[model samples]
Structures are given as structure tokens and as C-alpha cells.
Target: MSEKPVVRSSILPIPKSIGLVWLNIALALILAAIGLGVGFAQSGLAAQQVILYTVLMAATVFVLLNYVAVVFEARAEARAVASEEDQEAESSRLRQLWADNRVLAIAMATLLVLYLILTAAIPEFRSIKNLIGFLVLELILLFAFKISGYFAAGRSAFIGLIVLFALIVISAFSIEGFLSGPNIKAILLFAAFLGIASVGQTMVALLGGLDLSIPFVIGSSNIALLFLITLGVPSYVAFGFILVLGGIVGFLNGVMSYRLQGQALIVTLGTGFAVAGFTQIMTSIGSQFAGNVFGTVPGWLSNLAAMNGRFFGIPFPPTIFIWLAIAVILIVGLKTTTWGRNLYALGGNRRSARLIGISEFKYWVGCYVISGVFAALAGSLLLGWSGGAFIGVGDPYLFTTLAAVVIGGTSLLGGNGGYGFTVIGVLVLQVLTSFLLGIGLEYEWQQFIFGLLILPMVALYGRSPHIRATV
Candidate 1:
């Protein structure tokens, strides 16, 4: 009889990468040098010295762990000689493990490299707080990813929330006053604006279209609201008029883009430019600047979005609750309503949806109309927050709206994401911006970092087939 075949355990041996080990060592050495330099530059108080030495020790322990893991992996590989079939099977399993973990590994390496580079190159980054914050943040992310492996169904979504939690922790720990009442209120207030602004972009993306005109709509509506108010229109009345105008703009965008098929981006962008120019021209007829539209913001409107504004005697702003309400409504509406189902059907497969008697035209137009109304609402609310308006006021929304929607895991291809995800995305962006600002990063670096962060999400989602293809 043939000798019995040897069997391996279910868990695959950890794969080894010598390059990663070397990277860990290099980073450790750099970190040690930084620690020494800081010590020599200023031997501070007892507590400060303790923190510095603790950080160095943590780095040493981390490097030692990596080396120990690599050594174990090496020994395992050396002792694992077997038949050709077993060897091939083990190789396949190792490859699978590598594929599954390569992204996390690369992310960790990239972050560590950035940590070292930024700390060395940027004067602002050389602080002990920043060094500890970086380490803590990296560990949080690693823990989150490791825990995410247990719940495979919604791992990506869960990872986002975990990351948000991690950021909150890191920010609270590292920033002097990040969790202070004023700062918290500020973050929530701005998040409310972005969340509201993102509403239209989210809806449009769900329908497989983009409204580049959102920023323009935002700017124009912001100006228009103030202009109307200055013309003696009651604030509420002006608000209503502006919303209607936004809806009309949305209607035109939907109609024209629908007719043009693949030119939604171009059409909406052109429409936005035209609307912005027209609004600027109209508002500037008797004014000095295209962007300046000054008017007294109403008390009610101010209470709606101001950071100091309260909700039923609570310290929080009303805008936060309003956003929460809107998010809940949209989330439920998208998941349960007939219109929502039709919207998904239309987006997931237009041809099939038509066969099922769904009107693509109606849904498409309706989505843009909703988008326009939200953009207008955001602008109006922002007026209260800012107490004035400018033509470029809505400019930042151009990138952020899209980024929030995409970062929330909404497929740009449509029919796969919801307002719930967008809410998380909004929070993430707000917190991240606050964190960056706290750390003294410049605007350009923040934008650069944002772009880099978005690429990974795009690549991750792109790997999956679209909803239509899956169907």
C-alpha cells in the first residue's frame, strides 16, 4: 500500500517578503534617529521625555515583531518540503493569501513611508504628538482591517465606519481641542452643509449620471437667494423661489443630458457655467463684484445652520438634526419606495427597465430635479451659516460632493449605493478635514492627500462587476 499522504492544517503558513522586513527596519531606524534628534534638541519635562522614549520603544517592539514573524515564516517554509502535488497545492494557497492581503500590506507600507517622509521633510510634522498620533492611527487601521475579516458580507462598509471611529479617536487624542464643544459644533455644522450638498450628487450618481452643475447651482442659488432678499422679497419667499429655480435648472439638465446620452458630464458642466455666469451678471448689474451678494440673514435661517445654533435647548446645531432627518428619509425612500425601486431598475438596466414599464425619462429627470433642489437648499442653508454669498462659494462642493458619494461606496455606475453610505462619507470627509487642519497641513497638501485616498476606493470598487453585469 502507498504511504499515507501528509495533511496540512486549514490555516496557511504566513507568506514571507524580505523586502517588507527591510522596510520595517529602515523605518524603525529613521524613527529612532528622529527620537534622538528631538531629545538632543530639547530635553523637556519628565512627562515629555517619557512620551518620547515610549514612542521609541513602541517602534522597537514593532520592528522586532516583524522580524520574529519573518523568521517563523522562513522556518516553516524550510520544513514544508513535500510531494510535487502538495507543493503545488501549498503554493496556490500561499498565492491566494498574498492576493487577499497585498492591499493591506501595501497600504501599511505606504502610510509608514509617508509618516517618515513627512516627519523628516515638514517642520510641522516633527512634533511628538504627531509622531504618536501616526503610530496610533496606523495601529487602529490595522486592527480594523483584521477585525473586518470576520464579517465578509459588508466588510468594505464596516471598514469605513471603523476608520471613521479610528480617526475620531486619533484626532481627539492628538489635537489640543478637537473634541471641544466649539470644535465639535463646527465640525457638525460644516458636515451638515456638505451632507446636504451631497444629497443631489448622491441621487444623480445612483442614476448613473453626474451633475457637474451642482457647484454652479450652489453658487448661483447662494447669490440668487441673497439678491432676492435684498430686493425686498421675504427670506422665506426668496428661499422658495430659489429652490424652484434650482428644480428648473435640474429639469433642463436632465432633459438635455438625457437626449445627449453619454454627454451628461459635459452638458451639466456647460449648464453650470452658463447659470453661474448669468447669475453673476444679473447680480453684478448694480454691484462691484460677481461673487459678493450681501444681505442680512434671517434669524430663523441663522438658527438652522449656525454653529452656535441650538436644537430645542440642546447645545447642538439644528442643521445636524435636519441632515440626520433628511438622511433617514432618503435612505428609507431609496430602499422601499416604488420610485426608488424604479430608479434602481432604470439605472441598473435601462433596456430591461423599459421592458418592465419603467419610464427612464421620468426617473432620470426626477433625480436631477431632486439634486437641484438639494443643491439649492444647501446654498440657502449656507447663506445662514456664512451670512453672505459669493459666486465661488459652491466651488469646493464640486470635488467634495463627488468624493463623498464615491467614498461612501456608491458605485459611480449606479444602483449599488445609498444615502446611508453617503452619510458616512460625509462624516469621514468632515473629520478628515478637521484632522488635517488641526495638524497644520496646508490646503494643497489636503487636496493632494484626498486625491490619493480616493484612488484606492475607486480601484477596489472597480474590481467588482456593475449591478447590471451581475444581474
Candidate 2:
């Protein structure tokens, strides 16, 4: 053994930029293939599609070769790390290289594995049509990962806009009639409702609180408003009463949660349940259904939210304008008002706020009260749209309101977001929902995808230093 010393040989390093070039080429081919496939799947492929797909075939060969190259490179890196004299330094370099090129590395590895599995196990997966569809989705995932960096550093809302725009582009190209006037109007109509419902949630979140009662209040108020109208009460009067009822609920939520030391989530959820139960009991008195109310909504009220309803002779619904107005007012008010300033201060740091003469009770209670009123308003407006009221009508808002708030880039930790962010969030969610539906995904899939989407957003914000740390 002493006659010959063994020499360890390290594999050659592969430049990370090579992986990027491969990825870009793959994406270009995939996009062309997707546009051709989706655009011609119904009708026979046009000459244009034929030519494009032919080009795609050639590109696919190029991509496959690149994938092989990536595999060899990865193997080289692994062997180099194992054979290096200074294992620690080599490992550090390997990690740094991965950190610098993770998107490409992950994309290459994942696509290669999936391609191998699909081609081997499922022959149909090799079909041009299926392959194009698969690649389209892969493009979207890669794009999402590439842009996720924008979610960090408090750039959530801005990045949200980018995502929304991308969604619109992709949907318009992929789904027939996606950008048509009717679909556009439908999206706005739905967005208006969610936006109004989200107002309170946005406000409450700005102060570091959650209101689970919004959906419950919305349901109860929808029932109450229709029931009151049926019982011959004036519509305006009934609407005002519902708003007052919501205010009362919010007041209780704020007072109790504040006293309980910021247990807003539980307190509001409990309050919502109680309100829903009480409303059902009351509405059941002369109706066959516990939470159903049938009545004619006033024409003016119907115009507020109905898609066919117009604003100033314009085809657009008044509800959109209403939401726009509310957004503008809240955006300005939150910036210019003493109340807004104090709320932010209180939400940011209660102890410091107290020292500055800001009363946490007053601001906290006020925000919750505002949330309640908006929720009730949303419910009543919904009556105008639906033509009948059901207690479960607002049930969807429970998730949507909070989702809109979070997606809008509002911080749950308080003192960081505004209604402005909520508006973008509402639009993004509405558009996303529509896109998902248009593509024929079921509701369950939509929910699943939404859950997946929120995780990374939460992680992005969670990476920030805690509020306590800042203090």
C-alpha cells in the first residue's frame, strides 16, 4: 500500500448560466406549444399550429439534450463535493451555487424526473397535446417561483399586481372569451361584493385583529333585511337597522376581545356564531326555513349590486362605483385622519401608543365597529343582487374576506397594511377564481390551490423580523 498513493479526482464544475439558458429555451418552446394546443384543441390544428408545433418538436429535442447535460452537471457537482480535499469549503461552495441557481436547478431536476416517469409509465403522456398542456402548467409554476422573491420585503401588494396581470394574460390567451366584455363585467361585479365585505377585515387587520364574524353578520343581515322588507318595514329603515346591528356585534367583539388581551380571532368567531344562531331562531318564526327570507328588493337597492344595473346611465353597476368610492375614501382617510394615525400607533405598539395618549380601546373598538357596518352593508347589497336572502349567502365571505385581506398584502401582525392593498387583493382573488372556473377546475381544486398559494405568501411575510423584535 505504501508503494502507491491513491489520488482522488474531482468532477469538472458546470456553469450555472448553462442551466438558465436551457430553462429559457424550454419556456419559449412550451409557450408556443401551449398557445397552439389550447387555441386549436377544439378545431383541427391550423397550418400555423402545425408549423409552430413542428418547431416545438425540434426545440423539445434540444431541451431533452439540455436536460441530459444538467444531469451530468449535477452528478459532477456531487462527485466533486465527495472527492474534495477540503470537504467543508467544497460543501459551502456547493450550497452557494445552489442558492444562486436554485430556480434553474429545481426546474431542471423536477422536469427531468417528471418527464422520465410520465414517458415511462404513461404512454399517452407523450402525446403532443398532453405534453403541451403539461408544459403550460410547468411554465406557470416556474414563473411563480421566479417571482416569489417579490413577496418578501413588504412588496406583496406590488407583486400581487404582477401576479394578477400575469393571470389575466394567461387566461386571456388560454381560455376562449376570457377577455370578453361580459366576463370582464362579471369579474368586476363579484369583486365589488368581496371588496366591500373586505373593508372591515382590512381595517381590523391594520390594527392587528381578525373578524371572523363578517360572514356570519353578512348572512344574518341578509336574512334580516329581506325579512324586514317582507314584514312591511321601509327598505331604508331596515337597511339602517341591519347596519346598526352589525355595529353592535362589532362593539361587543372589540370590547370583549380587548379585555381578553387580543383574542380577536376567537372572540369574533364566537360572536359570529352567536349572531348566526340568534338570527336563525328569529327568522324561523314564520318561515318554513330557518335562514331563508323571500321578498322584493327595492329597485334602487337592486341597482346597487346587480350586473344589469347601471350607474348614471352607464352599463356598469353602482356597486363597483360604491366600492371604488369607499376605497378612495378609506385610502385617503387612513392617511390624513387623526383616527387613522392613532389606530396605526395602537396597532404597532400598544404600550408606546398609550404613552402618546392614544387609547387602544377607542381605536380598537372603532375599527371593529367599522368592520361590522361594512359587513352588514355588504349583506344588504347582496340582497339586491340575489333577489332573495339565505343565511349561508355570506358564508363564502368568511374565507374570501380574509383571503382578500391577506392577498392584498396586509400584515396580520398589525400596523402595516391599508384598504389600498385590499382592493388589489380583491381583484386578484376574483380574477383567480374566475380563471380557475373557466379552466374547468372544481371548487375543491380551487380551494386546494388557494391554500397552496397562501403558504408561500405567509412564509414570505413570516421571514420578516417580528413586531416585538422591532420594538
Candidate 2 per-residue lDDT over residues 401-444, each given as its tens digit: 98888878787888777888889889888887887687666677
The TM-score leader among the candidates is 1
Q: For candidate 2, which ten residues in a row score worst on lDDT?
A: 1-10
Cα-based lDDT for every prediction = 0.81, 0.78
Candidate 1 clash pair list? none
What is the Cα-based TM-score of model 1? 0.86
For each candidate, what TM-score against the reference? Answer: 0.86, 0.79
Task: Please list the Cα RMSD from the true structure of every candidate, rounded to 1 decimal place.
Answer: 5.0, 7.0
The best candidate in terms of lDDT: 1
